[model samples]
Target: MFKKSVLLYLLLAIGLVLAACGQSDQGSEDKSKEEETTQGNEEEKASEESGSESEEANDKEEDADFVAAYKEGKDELAKAGEGEEVDYQKVIDLYNNQLQPLVAERDGNIDQQISTALEAGKNGEMDGQVVKQIFDKLTQKVFYLTIKHEFQEIDENWGKKEEVNEEIAEAKEYYEVLKETVEKRDAAYETNMVDQIDAGFSEIEKAVENDDNLGFQLGKQVVDKTLMKTFYLAAGAVPNGYATKAAKEAEEDPDKAKVEQAEGWAFYQSISEYITKYAEEDAKIIEKNFNLETDVKELDPEAVNHAFVRGLSKVALHEYEESEEYWGEDKSAITALEGALFIDMIASDIKRMQGEDAYNTLNEQAQTYLDAVKSDEKEKAMEVLEKIEGTLNSIIEKAK
Candidate 1:
């Protein structure tokens, strides 16, 4: 009986061991399957993200290509307008070799149409009307680019406060007008206006070269005025033949000539109001900020010129009296004070030789001018202006 009981115990132990092995194998296989599934899902998600990034990149590339093509076309058109012969074949080659491939990827028809136009133009099969149409299309493209470029330029430079605040404001105003003019460009006047703008840009470049802020401001003003004239022309505010008529009338009638002269002066006054109003403020800022002892040689000629012109204009218009409002109870107006300060700063050595009394006399004369203008005494103001001019010239001569 004891031997039979031991055999039963051994059989039960063996059966339990086999069951445990089966369960271990099953768990291992299930875990392997889950890992494979998880890996596959992760790979799919990564691939999808990569595809989205690629698509976005391609879209941006296409936009850049479009802008480049438009700029190229407009540049070519501008060259033609300048009497340069248009190389239609070269343009066609560029389109086919570079631009068309980009368009092809997107299934666009623009490249094909442009190719056809260039071929037609090259073969001399296109009529004047067709040529005009092509040029017009190109000009329109240029207009868009001009607006974009100008706005970008302004935004980039707007933060640079190396210039006076008033000058910066004027530049912003001019840029705004230019943007609007480009947006609403009349087809008939496009070439003329663009030419004017280009000329103004040249002047601005010159101003930059000379380090003259006032010149830059005036150049930009010219561009603004040109754009305004173009706008007015398109709106028929000025008569179609007004220029010729005005010219002839000036030649024929003295009275008509005087009227036109007065009209011109009125226009000048209207446009220069801002300059007149801010001249004193600018001078005050300069006075407060600039250290004449250290910065005398480095003084901005443009600022000095701006102040000089403001004073000259006021005197010419018999509006010197109005400038007193800017002075309040101050002994001297801003321009006179600025001029005297400039002399003191630039000619300190000469001032030392001439004694303090001479300098005091100069200040007194400037004060006298301010008093004369405040009292509406034109004759006295004129006399003071002449004396001031002579004294300033003498000081400048001595400094040299």
Candidate 2:
């Protein structure tokens, strides 16, 4: 009985060993299969990402190229607007053949901008920022192309914009019409410096088209500040009835505004000669390469300065007592214009900062006062007001 029991126990031990070996082999095989499957999934994910990235890059390149073409074409159009020195006909051809076609050929770029925007989302792919960028670029391209095409048409029709035609009838200078009051004035012809201006204006426009800065300057110096001031002073002195009529017409009709402003700028340029000619050393600068036979008379730079000071002061006081309230968004533009007016005043003032138009200085001080208030300095604000009062008193004394 004892021998039989031992034999049965040995058989049972062998069967148990076999079962353990089978389980170990099954676990190893299962782990190997799982690793292979994971690797395959990783490679598929990587390929999808790379393909998406490639598509995105291609889209950006296409959009960028379209914008570039639009800009190049538009610059040519500006040259035409100033006066056609460029081959605007060629520009038109390029636009129709190149820019418009290229943009249209971008294969539904609007959809792509939208896709990119949607994919990015607002909270990290949620907002419409991407779509807006694409839309804005397209809008800009459309506008740029439209303006260029219109300008090209103008060139085709008008042949080129003309600045002044001696044959056409022109209104007389306001200064010449009212030479009595506001003393130290010279303009007498109702037709302000036409011959003096006509010769140079067209050339200046031409020089700009050719990218010749010096030539532009030579032409510019002829009528920029001096001639404009002359016209302004002349306009100020015009018979009250005509002056009111001119101002009223300026607001109602843009056509009249264009002509009047051009005439004003022309006289302003002539005025520069009054001050610059007196600085005999500057004659070389005035006569650089282009022989400007401007028979500029000598006037006290101080007188011109005073005129600019008083006139501009009135303009500023009228428009900008509280600048932020009136022109908040464009305050910087106003400040820059003020700086330019100051330069005009001082350059004209020359040696007589005292007797000259001190109005520019006082005007600057007023702007400074406005700036201080904007800065929230109440104590300094009072001081600024007092300084302005003192400056005005001094200005009044100088005028006397």
Candidate 3:
């Protein structure tokens, strides 16, 4: 009887141990699956967080009310060309009904210009083709300025992720409308500006995602300054600018040169405010020389070109000055990048004025300074920045 009881207890103990072991194995499998699921979820989240210009554009809401109205007006005007009999009354009605209200809400100046252009076209005071060009270019300017306004809104609404994201989307949409002009300049100058601008937009989206205000500011400068550079190239940059074209044509065909000068003047309006902010006198000279009211034969492309170089050099120097003041911080890095971009705006002219070797040296020094700023190497950054400043001062004097 004692042996029987002992054997029975031993058999019950073995059964309990086997059941526990089976549960342990099942729990281990469950844990392994949970870890794999967590890792996969993290990876998927990372993939969604990555952004691009196209992605931002895709995320944007459909065109705004003004955008639709502007497009409709543009289409209506497109039918009016050189020597083509246009329904002037129809264009007037379209502007009054569709564009005028939106322009008034957006910008009073734009409203006046559109109204003036429409009246001039209706009265036969301006050529139909000229009127159309004015209409399109002026509207494009409004779009560009709206982008700036959107950035300001983003800054104001910082930390409100939804509002900030919406503003960014709006800005991206406006940029898309202006992209053709960027592409045209890139093709003409053989520069990769479109890529630069796209990278800037990407930086902006990433900054927004990370909730980094300084990063957003830095990205904004990249996009803003690059677009400014585009307009500068259109207006007065060497080798292929309207100023150069106008000068070349002036001697052979004054009328055609006038048209080119007018184009330069129109494009210059985009960057004139920035130039004026830094170098008022230089801005005045540029504006006067490129003024449509000024005869093409009287326009001095050389003087206009020189003024642009001087003004931009001053602007670059100011950026470096700000970088110096904000040393050892992200602002320093931001201004350093701005200084480099401003220098790059006149790179072709720099290469022409200072030999290629000299321009290369300057570029290398600028890049070194930027790196030092980013790394928080105050002394090294200051040393390189001073050298860059001195070189720019010399360039400014020569430009005079």
If both were scored by lDDT, which would come out higher, candidate 1 or candidate 3?
3
Q: What is the TM-score of each candidate against the true structure?
A: 0.27, 0.24, 0.78
**Residue-level lDDT for 126 in candidate 2:** 19
Q: Candidate 1's error at 104, in angstroms?
A: 7.2
Identify the leading candidate in terms of lDDT.
Answer: 3
- Summarize candidate 1's per-residue lDDT along 1-55 as a digit string, tens digits: 0122322332222111101001111112122222358788787667766865676
Error of 3 at 342 (Å): 1.1
lDDT of candidate 3 over 254-274, digit per residue (tens): 766766775787677677766
Cα deviation of 6 in candidate 2 (Å)?
99
Ranking by lDDT: 3, 1, 2
Looking at candidate 1, what is the lDDT of residue 106? 28
Error of 3 at 31 (Å): 49
Candidate 1 CA-lDDT value: 0.41
User: Model 1, which residues run further than 4 Å from truth?
Assistant: 1-36, 101-113, 127-182, 186-400
Off by over 4 Å in 3: 1-65, 75-81, 101-106, 251-255
